[model samples]
Target: MPSLHEFATWEPLLRLLRTGNAGNLAVPGGHVAGQISHYGWSLPLQRRIPRPGQAAQVEDVQDEFDAVQRVQGALADIGADTISFTAEISPTGRSVLHLISPGPAVEPGIGGPHPGSLILVEDSVPEPWRRLPDPVPGAVPAPSVDLASLERTLRERVPGAVGATEAEIAATEARLGVALPDELKVLYRVTRARWEDWGEDHAVAERVFTAVGCELFPLDDLYIADASSRPCPWRFGAREAVVTPPDAAVQGLVGSPGWIAFGDNGGGDRIAVDLTPGPRGHTGQIIMLSHEDNIGAGLLADSLSQLVLEGRGPGRRGRHGDGPPAVARVNIRSLDSVRAAAHAGLEVLSLGVWEGAPFSLAPVTGLPRLRTLTAYPGTLADPMEIAELTVLEFLELGPEDWRVLVDAGAVPRGLSAAAIEVHGSRHPLQVVALANELLTLWDRPPITRTIVEGHLEPGV
Candidate 1:
């Protein structure tokens, strides 16, 4: 099965899953496209193929990545109304908390699970990716936190970091008017006051004071607020406030009003807290800069405890992969496109909405890497030729389709997963019985998985 990162075609689908901001995302290709939201992914199975020049625009794309770029370009037309791309990326992202502020465009970070990753829809991007030169090998589970235990885990992982002392914490508290949050204070006491490290790309990579993002103050010299300090947040699709003519020595240019700038993710982004509470806001509220839109100093977590829990929560890390070549959904009006794809190294094909289409698989039987084939296979094609596919692993069709393939002794070997939708004239028992009869044809078991409609059945 493909991981969330692998399907470039499903990039928007993946993004919607990662960030629950609802929207429709898909390229013009029939390769992969879907409508998704907080609900679920509903694939746009069929796209009407434009004939000559009947209003539909034709786009030649390399793959899903190219498709996204092309589609974005198309949407970003000058004076384009209602059809504009959003530059707002959610800060509370999936695993990696990307701060999409209006400023410099941040490049996508590398490796597994870290902030600075966001959808290209927003304009504001934080600092570049950061990875320890040689990270200590271990993954900490963050289901719920054990403060002392996590502190010890961090120290053990990065033994070179200098741990903090009680006096150091007390001195810092004295310097800053407000006392540190109990959690923060305890965290500092247990772990290093701040740690510095190098990265493969960044020559002098360092956060405010913590490995998470920003450097702990005093660990790095505190600087007066200036152009070098404040980042210009991209306020596309939003009207986030800015700190024009910022305070000479302000912490965050547009963050909480009476907040202490504790750490930064080295991306000109800060993780701070508002010690002073107002009617609307409360003390100990962990406020951070918005990575998307013009929203500034939004409430990230209610407290430091929430921040810790989110950062280290179990199974919340980002998925990382080199990724395979993204495929596009092609309009299978006829077998011509299918033949072209197979000839051009099409490995997997899902011909949905095949009810009345002129579909046939006979032309592309000998392709080298054509493993998975999904289709209703009736409208204008015979299903028997599917047996010619020697490397079939996954299939989606109806019971009659399976019967045709089986009667002709054309069922592919080692079929692992299949969804055989049974409907129209066929009873559930009849379909189930047919499936069992087909099973008898196999030497052992033909396929590892099989499902009838939405339910599961053994040996499909």
Candidate 2:
């Protein structure tokens, strides 16, 4: 139970967050342990709680896998390019130690360019907003705001938004020929004039929801995908799909969803509303679509306000940091961060934006247990050290000596899979030979050889 002071500035990220415990489907441990969730809390960072004499309970690979997938689902709701979650339980609730990533989801193929915005209001801009146009002597301050109109606009017009002027908002509604739901005006003034704009003063009033047993959390954050960016691969089961570009067909797909894009999960998906309603949806009704859910572009939420209020529902409080730090991705230049992650028991490492400089696998060998490594081979001065890991199951890159890592006995005996890319090299036979050896080790079929015009026939 550490004090509030012990946390980073992201503290407001969890403020007023409701917490509780629920009995979930029992995990393999055969214990119906209490499930902890936060209705208004989420962050990304790996954290550890000091257990003076107790053994540290680390979650296994499956648990990490499940958690990551669940986070992926949530992120898509916000149209974000990344996600951050915490697990370390502190006095107030869960205290995270290492999670702080907003990167794309890790999959077989590359993640797309995350082109969206993420702004947390309450935390960044506290109540009594910065430019509170001073209160007048008699008339109620800004009571010109019409509640019923605002609420109606939130429910029927958009998924919910604010921080802009009435005139600006009107113009957008007029242009789109679709009036926005009232919830936005009721929350904060629209930020700008365009349909997707948020009023410059994005903060909400304090104690504004005292009437409700639980306060209403506004839809303060916004993330609209920019079509100019490229798309990423979205994997669901064995199939893969690419989301539509901004200017392509199906007006409600990725970059060009006719309605306002309010959410993204960093994976290739978004929750959007239609300004130009079509056969698939009506104006203001929400829908979600991505490369994976191409066929599921139907009505999602009724209005912007409902989406936020319902989406912000409360959950259990405490989370145990029993899972190992599964993925640690650091910039190649931040060797210190890499070293720090290894020291903290990171199991999977993804490093670099490599240059032609020499790099060594030395710093990572210090990790008592590292199972997977993803890095660029061009930077490695000595990838030969990879042969040393007893538990290495996957090597993301081909070694510097790819031509003979296996025949030379440099590939670790435990390494089962590696993406060996020898696109235009002189010796393709050596790579085929190594591939055959690794396949044999895994008890899988070997490569089917094809003959060169004047070389030995196929496998001959």
Candidate 3:
């Protein structure tokens, strides 16, 4: 199975596979493109095709020491340039993380470095691919189509797709405060705010809607899928890689926006996407990003699967490999989308969103099959709607939103099987009430201190 980092790094390798060539190559992980990490190359300087179990060995100690020292110096010089690449045809990711030669390590023969021997250097803690740091203060936000423009296009262009009016968009933005990202803005303008809709040209409209194009390449067992139309082609660098069918078979495996689909390619490479929290079960599950649109539903799905895997109370965080379906955070905007995802064999969904956006409580009613629901700080209007889901086992409600749930008529009354955690919020009294209710209603209340601190507890 692939780790979160491996899954992302494989995009380049996967993109290479689309060319109909299956070969072994390493893709560095964590290092930015054009970054200078440890510098060294194959001695024979030839592309290697490692045979089954024929591990690439270190032939000379002096040459190896020289190479290792040089590589380390390069890393220190570049301030953390070691690269990690996922192999195009290897499943074990046996050597996914590697250091790229910053320059060249040429040690006069002690066994003039044999080919394929990796020289280790100072490995720096790689920073995550952070979204462009929140636009600098007073910076000009990228220009994008407004909600009105999107509404007009939808009304005048793709009349059949479901859409929100300009006023609705304003109301949502007003409720949230932060401006929508430019990528999202462009999508809304062209696709009427619906990310899933493939619009007029299944191919063309999808580009506008998804902000991703159809160019693909293969790397290891992963294929990097790119959206050509967008300015930032590297949607977080090689956005996604999969080993699924060509365009025709992709639809079958693409459950929603965040997840990608893949298929087996005979014997070239076996793919694995590991989102599981621990070491053992990690390889079997897929990793995903959460969204506010369907975050609630996504959470429910996650919690449901978690319950099945971990069981109640102390059993939730069990041993490494013996868990249920592995899940990650994701977003869900519409009930239809959530239902469709459910039908498509998606056992878990991850999401992050505001409280009052109708999602916090709506999933309880909208996504009947959801099991876990997680969220961040924000206000909420209603919470009573999801009071009766028996299957729900994990509820991660932020502190700010806890009070609304407590005040709502429904949440307290229908509480059952799951553990309800109130994250940081503004109201302590309310959190207490909610926690108290959980203790009273369920045999084992899932409330914890994190909830109180995130909301009521200060300096948290």
Candidate 4:
């Protein structure tokens, strides 16, 4: 057996072995194997045992599949838009590089995202080996992520997050007038910094879950730095519905920032994310309503949040790179709470309030760092106060808030780009003023803008 001093990381010594290859090498106990090459790690068969001798063949196929899925799921969970892998095993004695392969990248939408590419070779090689696989039609190389290094980087860069003790967590729930899902709490206890390369997958995953009409909630709130030692709050929610089909209508919710609605087919009109008695509002965090529900104030909030997160401008995160400083283009329902939260220095704030609720914009003071704000088509509490946010870059206002913008005299400072859906507003003049000057509104046609405000000058 190798001495403890000889090893570095745990689960070391990975290697791979082909199913039909007779070049078996004897390995010590600490080694692991991996199979790289022609066999495309059949994932469907994993988790099922075969009949004795056949068990090795089927189990190998399945074991490889399990490995691929395990890693793939992790990748997707973290938002790696794509990944793939091949299979192999470790040697018996050595612990490092025993069974491994060059995991490859797999693009989603093509027979699903492939797991990372890997190779299971014999345990004899002391030096790390890299062997290329023959080109398989559907096979793609997986993108590499130094997860450990990344974790270390996060630890180094971000300040440590203090977690809520059991009692404190309970007190927060009592004070907030809502009960948080355990999964979300877990996520909060961990960390919320968005992982590199995983944003797309996370977005896609949210879309998939939302498409099924399940209630979706942003999990960004629960992410904290003190999370390494504790269970992830988001995981608590995930555990409840892990067995639920990925496409099922009752998926667990995610509470991250940047809520996006991908494609058009919402699985009918099922409710996604349930915020019920939470801080956001009654619609249960961020949710997508049926077409009828879309007009609801909460629907507007969800839409606005989605819009602001998508547009190209100063505030949005933008595409992977060089696409533009994409602003979050949103179709919102209200701005009341967002206004307050903004003053709280919160860069990312959740929007929740079913559409059709009364509009009010309570002033949010002191949140100088607030960068983004979203709301649905509800009324405003104090519209004029919005101009005070000199640093505000992205502003998604509910329909009623347009009046407040027009009344404010000038376009809100620092708002170079924005997105909003002005539906069923009581004042057409306010809407016209918005379409004419401030926003690059999309849902309504520009021609309509001329007819409504053509009589009046661009301002009022």
- Most accurate candidate by lDDT: 1
Those runs of model 1 whose alpha carbons end farther than 4 Å from true positions after fitting are 1-336, 355-357, 377-380, 443-460
What is the full ranking by lDDT, best candidate first? 1, 2, 4, 3
TM-score of each: 0.29, 0.31, 0.22, 0.23
Q: After superposition, which runs of candidate 4 have C-alpha atoms over 4 Å from their true positions?
A: 1-345, 354-363, 425-433, 439-460
Against the true structure, candidate 1 reaches a TM-score of 0.29
Task: Give the Å error, residue 214, model 3.
Answer: 42
- By TM-score, the best candidate is 2
Query: Clashes per prediction?
Result: 36, 60, 68, 158
* lDDT: the better of candidates 2 and 3: 2
Location of the lowest summed lDDT over 10 successive residues in candidate 3: 451-460
Which one wins by TM-score: 2 or 4?
Answer: 2
lDDT of 2 by residue, 213-324 (tens): 1223233333333332224322111011122222221232223323455454335455555444333223454455555532324444444544444442221112213443
Q: What lDDT tens digits, residue by residue, belong to model 4 across residues 1-460? A: 3221122211121111222221333322211122222223322121446677663565555545554444444444544433222222233232222211112111111221121111111111101011111122332211222234433433343335233456755664564445554433442333332333134456644532332223222332222111121222120111111111222221212221112222122344322223321222322223343333211112322222232233211111111223211222212443343433333424433344554454343444445555555555554456666676566545556555655675656446555334444443123233334444442322212212111000111111
lDDT of each: 0.39, 0.39, 0.30, 0.32
Q: What lDDT is obtained when candidate 2 is compared to the true structure?
A: 0.39
Decoy 3 TM-score against native? 0.22
Off by over 4 Å in 2: 1-305, 308-341, 351-357, 366-369, 399-404, 408-410, 423-430, 451-460
